[model samples]
Target: MEYNLEVAELEKKYSNFHLKHINIKLPKGKIIGLVGENGSGKTTTIKSILNLIKYDKGNIKIFGKNTNNLTKIDREKIGVVLDDSFFAPILNVNDINKLMKKFYHNWNEKYYFEKVKKFNIPTNKPLKEFSSGMKMKIKVLCALAHEPKLLILDEPTNGLDPIFRYEIVDLFADFVSNKENSILMTTHITSDLEHLVDEVIFILQGNIILDIAKNKIDNEYGIIEILPENISKIKKEDYLKCLKYKNIYYILVDSRLEFQKKYPKLEIRKPTLEEIMLILVKGE
Candidate 1:
């Protein structure tokens, strides 16, 4: 299969943290959401793919070429926006615009200025004076201005309000409308992504524990609420994981069909991404 980006057996280690055997693929024309808690190695994974830090060992490829040998053409096809702006703090938006035109061969002047206006960033003020959200918007603006084939974003919506967040997410939807474009974004805002992503990859403490299509969760994954007496009716083998409360059991089932077959009369509800994350991380 043709993939926009791929990582295999990726390993990275620090004093107190380790990312082991990380493997994931971003296909052409698809948006994949990377969801995890604060210290789950999301940023580390992204950095590793971009070769920003030295990974212990692994294979990372973009557009069919190994990242180790990424050409200038390959680099040009990818846009990246991280939590912190990489631009010089002393430069204003206009100054950076003039400078970036010399940097990217395909920089779109109209699109760049349009994004600045759309984001309401101060044209003359230094980047250091912009708010966190404003800085983030400017960073995204720069990334998108070059019309890259792939976008790698880390925590893109963390500080923005609802309106800007929704607008940016919608812009992402439009970007991937072309089959050649794709995105791999890590975000804590699961709600914003529930309807936007094609695939959801859940990473926890550096390991990828869940990888599934967004639609499959609604049809295949489910949660069952049962009283203690009925717990045995739903076989232990049927549920992926579960937790018990005062007088009830909250069970997470891998197959809703199996869950329904076991408890035809019981209630099973659609579990949200957040709930699944919670159950996986906090449940027994």
Candidate 2:
């Protein structure tokens, strides 16, 4: 399969944290979500992949070229929106447009302004004066104006209201409508990811614990609540994780149908991405 971005055995070390041998493959025309608790290395992994920070070991390839060797022309094909990174606070919409044009060879000035108008972003107001939601929208719009093949975003929908969130989600859907485009993003908002992503990757304490397609998650994974006394009735291999609270056990099983066939008395329900992550990270 052709991948727009590839990371293999990527490792980075810090005094307090370590990102260990992370591997990811983002196929063309799909959106992948990187999710984990705060301080679990989600942002660290992204920074490493983008070469914003140095990795001690491993390879990163974008558009089939090593990230270390990507030329200015190659870099132009990737758009990025970082959580804490953006243009200077003093730059207004027009000032940003002029500056970006000098940086990106394929920058679409007309498209950028059209988005500005459509989103009703203040053309003359400095970025510092904009609301958080407005700032995020402008950043996203700038990323899209370059018409990149791959979009790397960190919390792209962080501060928007429901209405604007829906619009931004729709815009993302349209971006990957072309078979050549792809997106990789990290968001704390699992609900948005539930509707937007093709696959979800769960990282915990610097390790990737799960990587699965959205359909498989929806169709195969399940959650069951049972009394603590019934725990032994469940085969160890049948369940992926188990959480205990008071007198009840919440179990995460990989195959709902098969587990149901085995234990007909226990109730099984579909597991959401957030629920699954909770179980994996906090369960034993």
User: All candidates: CA RMSD in angstroms?
Assistant: 2.0, 1.6
TM-score of each: 0.93, 0.95
Error of 1 at 6 (Å): 1.0
List, in order, the clash count of every candidate structure: 0, 0
Off by over 4 Å in 1: 225-234, 243-249
Candidate 2 lDDT over residue span 1-284, tens digit each: 89999999999999999889789899999999999999888899889988989899999999988998999998898988888889889999999999899999999999999989999999999999999999999999989999899999998988988888899999999999998899999987888888889999999989889989999999999999988888998888999999886778999999999999999888999988888888899999
lDDT of each: 0.88, 0.91
Candidate 2 displacement at residue 269 in angstroms = 1.9
